[model samples]
Target chain A: MSRASNHQALLAFLDTIRRPDVAAIDLGEHENLVDSGLIDSLAVLQIVLFLETEFGISFAATGVDPGRLYTVSSILDLIDEFG
Target chain B: MFVNLDVGVLHEPLSGRRWEPARLRLEVERRAAHYRQQQLAPGDRVFIGYGNCLEFFADLLSVWQLGATAVPVDARLTPFEIETLVRVARPRLFLHQGELEPSLAPIFEACNVSPLDTDAVPQSEAQVPVSSFTLDDDALILFTSGTTGDPKGVVHTHRSLRARWIALQQALGLESYRRTLCLLPTHFGHGLICNCLYPWLSGQELFILPPFSPQVIMRLGALIDEHEITFMSSVPSVWRLALKTARAPQKGSLKRIACGSAPLTAHLWEQIQAWGGTSEVLNTYGITETGSWVAGTTGGPFEAEDGLIGEPWGAVVAIMKSDDTAIPPGYGEPCATGETGFVWLNTPALMKGYLNRDDLTARAVSQGWFMTGDLGYLDAQGRLHLRGRTREEINKGGMKVYPADIDAVVERFAATRDMCCFGFDDPLYGQNVGVALVLEDTSADTLRELHAWMKHHLAAHQLPVKWYLLDAIPRTSRGKINRDSVAEACAAHEPVDLANMLGAGR
Candidate 1:
């Protein structure tokens, strides 16, 4: 999948995370998912499942890189690399 | 310091003909070769949530053989938490050693595991290639509850975990017992290493059961008798229940009953001793970050002192003051023999660091000691006594609610205000969640409406069972609301005769 297409899918998944409407997540900006308070460890799972089916990639418990998964940019980059 | 405790003694009869370590390695190697054929690499991470004893050990040994790391996720996690961990750890394979419920069926990647799966074959005689590994190698990755903050993955290297097991061997002086029952899940620190791995590695046999229940322990009595079982370790709660409910065993040989993971109340300890099963009741102290058996009471002369966690096991303990300095002469923060502060340990068994969390790794470990967030003191006799944890106070039965979790739901209500919530002590539940509110209206359904909304959005445990309305919550000068004060205010009780509230139950 192209990075642009991956980004689109990522935005939709993030949108469904059940944050308050008042919190108003800006999908185009505030790229740091942790800092933006948009996603936390719980959200990470949904994203992983999405990545597995969408990108045809899998992760193992031992070789997980938190930095690659914690942030949206890094996650997209990881998907691109694995894809 | 002198060696006050005996290091080695066989407390239980042999459970079986002693199984040599070479035989175990051979079995593990066979399993490892099979796993490798399925494309699992030496560095890959896999989740072992299986509750079965054989699969747990074999999968673990397979990981050891492949020079890979195994992360055991507790199967008891609420579905939400399990989903969270699977994503965080990103295990390629999720092994179900126990029965898998339908809820977990959706997310779990299809695997060759599961006893009923036709694809899986038991390797009666298998061999694994020799792999290079060290004590410092990452052996296991376990997660903290994240009760207060985000749960971080704790990573223990082989060296650290093995050193811990060796220290336990020296501390408890374990001999391979004949039939041992494992009640705690493998995901837990105390159960996996202390109860299972440590015993198996020492040529002992382990009998696996689901988490402890009175019925289960009673059934185990027969197995113990059948197998000539000896030593057992379990959480105090399980033993307390077993003592209360189970029929007293007749003509059984259970030597040492060790309890840890939570405080062992003296009342409960005395009850266990009262039962015909006479064994040295040892109270152990350790955490997930510390590779299981860190400090514990020995079978030798031990004072029945309440709160004493005993001295460190083959490790050094330091009590640090609020200023991040070791308290001088051990009086401040309870390190000097009778003072209390934050407890820290320099041990070979400490985990290398939090998995993928360098920031947390740096904060928790400093100058070679892992700073356990638990608050406790060391008496002059060098025994440690824990007071409580430094993290947010939890009232599992009371009103100390997780504000983040509560607020997450309250904000969803149309008429609700963005307000702070906290927990207070409730007589019925240990801790109950109470929210300081600024809602538009106060009708009779206020409580009913709030409860209904929470039920849909929050887990039963996460819901605030009680609600308290406040004009505004107290805030610090820097603009952070002081939750401790809010909680204290909520806790302060007005003397009310029970007759008044219930009206003598008409």
Candidate 2:
């Protein structure tokens, strides 16, 4: 559970679902969160339903690569290769 | 006139080869002899901006086999919406395929650029001449997904796109052994004229997909049984995210399933009829000034109703009155037979206007119908229904409401997964109700139990006096709902105690 606390618990769940005057920056764990608009395409389906309900994990049973769920160090290497 | 179909690329994440229909008509006649070696005349225009490959359908069939026009755009627009569409489509060729948004380099150096590359695919053997340009010329421009404003363009012609591919081959009987499965975005008209030019002019078999990710629509039941895919069309948010992560397709390899640009929630049309074990799900209706799908729903099993849509086909629909007139056909005019108003239409596959806006083509056409800023009704068994968008209705103090009846009571809230319901600037109701949402639990006790189930199924000027939550519900790259950015994120949020959560739900 520690990649700096999974990047501070994924930037505190993307600053509690972003856009309320955005602000919470520091994203670079290999940046690109959806080509830099910092998350979209429905926040990549709310980060795959927040890693299947906050880390029970299962991006279709870990065969991950939906383009490495678009960055923050490839979603912390897909939650350390599928949580 | 020559597109005898058989194109099959299936998974082109930037050229992973695989095309055939005689190498996609010899790469569309060597890109129509490089648009007749750049003299590009026969009614010019061009633009394209490619993306979902096969070299964006061979530069849109070599700019409609050189009778020219083909505008296309939307490679996720914005370099100020491609410099307001190259300052309103003054294109004599912009033909892009990659890299040209360094703020559109002086609008691609004032037009005439061309590089739509797949390694320039033209190994000669050129027979280029065929377009003496008739079918009254113009041939396709498309745009309008400017979610309730600005993006205009529209146009069409080549005899209103062969009367919308002969009204979708006489209302969806489209043959040539069907195949289909294209996955939207061919710069809209429901993915370039109903999923890729009416299945490439009804000589069918196209597979395409790539670029539409809910992990590529939860891998549509293994790409519809490895492309045996018999017919599909999208947008009901990609069949409600492929009925929540795909997987149900093995009964007779899915014979049909449509669901047009928006309206279709009868619980996602009965979960896309039990996940395409087929009742041929249809439920369409049209726009982009009437060309794409001029009304649908038929092919049996039915029950979803809320602007049900069902009957127009070659088109005529009416109901009018927001001053463009019509509403008089029978049972007492206030929009007779079943009541709602403003839908219109009249189609021979409409549109040949709006490009240079003649004041929005005289307020969206009049003497020959086409008003369609939507809001609908027809019924007493004539079928039409739709009831939202005449600028997203919701008047509050004068009472009008319809945000698809508060998105069918906030999509029956099992923690709501998407929703919009707009109309915001209310100085005591000149326009009020707001809404936003997109939750499966934005937890604050799941938004105070969805504001106590939308104050027990709405009606206090149809509730929602602003409430945003939103982790998504922005849309419009033709999945619609960008209701002016969900009424500017429900008028920049800040109304969340919801009167102590509707007085603690009574």
| Highest-DockQ candidate | 2
DockQ of 1: 0.01
Residue-wise lDDT of candidate 2 within B1-506, one digit each (tens)? 54334554433522446676677777778778877787787787887876466777877777777778888876655454565566667677777754555767766676545434445546864675576577777888876633112446789887887787787788767653277767666777777787777776565666666545567676677668766687777766555455544566664687777767665668768777777777777778767677778888763555787558778888878785564433322322447777888777777878888777778777777665667778888887787888886555554432345576567768778988888777776432346677888787775667766766765555344667568776787777888776777777666666554434433433
lDDT of 1: 0.61
Candidate lDDT scores, in order, read 0.61, 0.67
Worst 10 residues of 2 chain B by lDDT: B325-334
Report how far residue B459 has shifted in candidate 1, in Å.
7.5
Candidate 1 chain B, run of 10 with poorest lDDT:
B1-10
Residue B501: error of model 2 in Å?
9.5
Q: Candidate 1 lDDT, tens digit per residue, B1-506?
A: 11011111222222333334454455566667766666767667777765544545656776776777888765555555556666566666666644566665665643332222212536653754667566566778877545223557889887788788788878777653444667776777888878877776665667666654323543444545665667777766555434433445556577777778766667667666555376476778877788876886663577566676777896887777752534322334433556777778878888888877888788777667777777888776777788776655444421123466567568767768646677665322334566666676655455446656765555555655445565566677888876677666545533222222222222
Best by lDDT: 2
Residue B260 accuracy (lDDT) in model 1: 80
